[model samples]
Target: MTEINENALAKMREVVPESQIHYLTKAVSRDDKNKLGCEQKNGRNVSADGIFCGGYHPKSFHVAYWGHADLTARLLEADPEWNWEPLSVDDRGLPAFDQNGGLWMRLTVGGVTRLGYGDSQGKTGPNAIKEAIGDGLRNAAMRFGAGLELWSKSDLRSTQETDDAREWLVEAQAAADVPAIREIWQQARAAGADVDTLDKITILAQERMEGGA
Candidate 1:
């Protein structure tokens, strides 16, 4: 697990629009089926779930681009001039697929290009090709810092303290002994609580103390 930096997330929100982040933030449990029998528009999506679906995808980034027009759609939506070229080619100058049914896609945006690899071997038939192309491009874009927050899953994004943190706050508040509560603040500061966090702790503790009183 990696540490989540508070400032970095705010930066990602600016660089990548929330419209794109929402898809990356989505999660479906193994038994959840609201999306069952529905295919993404244009097959452009790069889902967190693999072709067949099972466990949820990593929540750090858009797990999958949905729809058939995925790679093209993302580029056009962001920068109309964006397009992709196959990094690997056959003798006929066509896009090439490897033995594992993977392809590398090179995406050029505003004249700059990036190469990303895709694997849709798990999928069968024609759509496999489309999926590979989209996934490869998405993977490459992420490398460009397109979705830096995707580097950390949703759980890691929040600045709000955890249940444990809140528990400590509440416990300290309820403590009748001053030294006991002081110890809580000390522990919290050592754990890297920010000024705002300490303020919140004080406020929460006061409310608890007052309520008990």
Candidate 2:
């Protein structure tokens, strides 16, 4: 079982934005400490659970499954512009985290979920439901204890798309400069977007302010 270090969690929160923070917990399977639906911990052979906390993207609101190696490879193969790494796999070669485990944190900005994966095989089951509940509970706990922002399914982007967008934006902004900013501004102005769109522009501007460009 992985250790849940409160100090590490606190530090993680500090690094992550309060607006992007989310929380979820899941039960691990005993039959497979790493697989879904196998009970293995707490002497009851209950599934091992994890607490996931992070941001939600505006595109694909689901980030957990997108982290899967299979999914990441497919996505990257399809688009070399993607700037994220696949989730690490355990000794069994399964993705480090699956839909059945925990609600992994996903950061999303400008319609993308940052660092996460989605399972394309669609092997969801009991563990999937358990994971969802865990995610909800963890999110509630964080919102109650830390005053972080929380959004419903519809309000946030689907986890998968959101995960991709966030990472791409991060990478793109990293290589951005005054010229890039000018382009973004030009595009936004040309589109005559609403306040929210401009707000995203502002956020991107702030990132540039902090040397993201």
Candidate 3:
């Protein structure tokens, strides 16, 4: 694990300049191995959650990759110029050396970066896999949007919660019940719906009733 993290970091340092480089390491915790720290509203792992990065703003862009040690070796072999410091393990036995910990690397890039995590064992070097993950994330980000806005946990969670709203809307639409819509609008109002989002929902409801999509 140490080898992989080191290799991945090294590759990143090599790919980017030292002036642009930033290294994040955990501060160590009692339950790092057993459970994840509390998830932040921004989707970052807080110290309480067992995630430690050197320094990062909640809105900062990050590129993460997870893979086996062999991938690290391949990355270093492919790019000997890269360099990195080895992070030490904590008491829970979570370090680069422990297989259970897996290899983790995060980098900040000007543009969107790619990311991927493999579930099965593969022949590719961990470094290559990480590189590919970075590439994939970058590509996806480019097609839609960029920046750390996509990294917001609260917003993403809110959107996920909308899935329930959407389902309810579908059911209501099928029934074409104005009373049902009124009930929902009242509920939304009581809940203190954000003016902007509520306005959009209102438009949707209006369109649906008007036989327009």
Candidate 4:
């Protein structure tokens, strides 16, 4: 087996920052008659005031993701010469799709190449092609540990917990008085918030005070 460099792998696996993260809502029917039925909507499309208007549907849930641009940025940051190519092309020189309408591709970064496959998820036309390419990139990037957190069950649970704590912290920061903020901080600390959460609480409190809020 070929050995991967520890430092290189570490750099590739670095946790993606929250600012670059995006969320999409996905829903699946729970009824036995339609268990396989599903739908997906982009984050913007499902926002509180977006087309869906009332926010996510009862059966839908959000999933964290990095957009194609964000993934490309990460690849470039990890390996400036990173590149990818379709596994096959048609007579017209366009990328060819498989029997299932999925595309197969290879992604190479830092001299390591890996195969990945993607599909349009029932979509058709130019947008479907773009979506396939983006999905393929993300699938291949996973082999190199890029954006792995979004794919990890344990990490997802931890992230959810952190999100809950952050929500409380944010509410505290938005309180009308310093004392109210301090009280929330006490509750958060007593709940065994992590170091990062504690630090955030302190920083938010400082910002609130500095702004006379």
Q: Best lDDT goes to which candidate? A: 4
lDDT of 4 by residue, 1-213 (tens): 555445655667888898887766443222213222223354332221122323435333456778899888888887787789999999999899998889999998777789988888989999999999999999899888988888785366567757877787778867888788788776765454544665677787888789887
- For all candidates, the clash counts are 19, 42, 15, 0
Q: Which pairs, if any, clash in model 4? A: none
> Ten consecutive residues with minimal summed lDDT in candidate 3?
111-120
Q: Candidates' TM-scores?
A: 0.43, 0.19, 0.26, 0.55
Candidate 2 structure quality by residue, lDDT tens digits, 1-213: 433334423432332243333333322111223322222222222211122232221111122211133323333333333332224556985435554554333422222334433332333676664444334333432332222323343235335334644543454465457567556654543332223444455577777778745
Off by more than 4 A, model 3? 1-159, 189-201, 204-213
Please state the error at residue 195 of candidate 2 in Å: 7.2
lDDT of 1 by residue, 96-148 (tens): 98888889788665445668888885897788887787678767776555554
* Candidate 1 TM-score, true structure as reference: 0.43
Query: RMSD to the native, candidate 1?
Result: 16.1
Q: Write the per-residue lDDT of candidate 3 for residues 1-213, one digit (tens) a residue.
A: 123334333343333222332333332222224333334543433332223344442212222332224334434454444332214446775423225323332322322223322222332566654544444333333222232232354356457546745654555455455556666665644443333434555666777678743
User: Each model's C-alpha lDDT?
Assistant: 0.55, 0.37, 0.39, 0.71
**Candidate 1 Cα errors over 4 Å, as ranges:** 1-14, 21-74, 154-213
Best by TM-score: 4
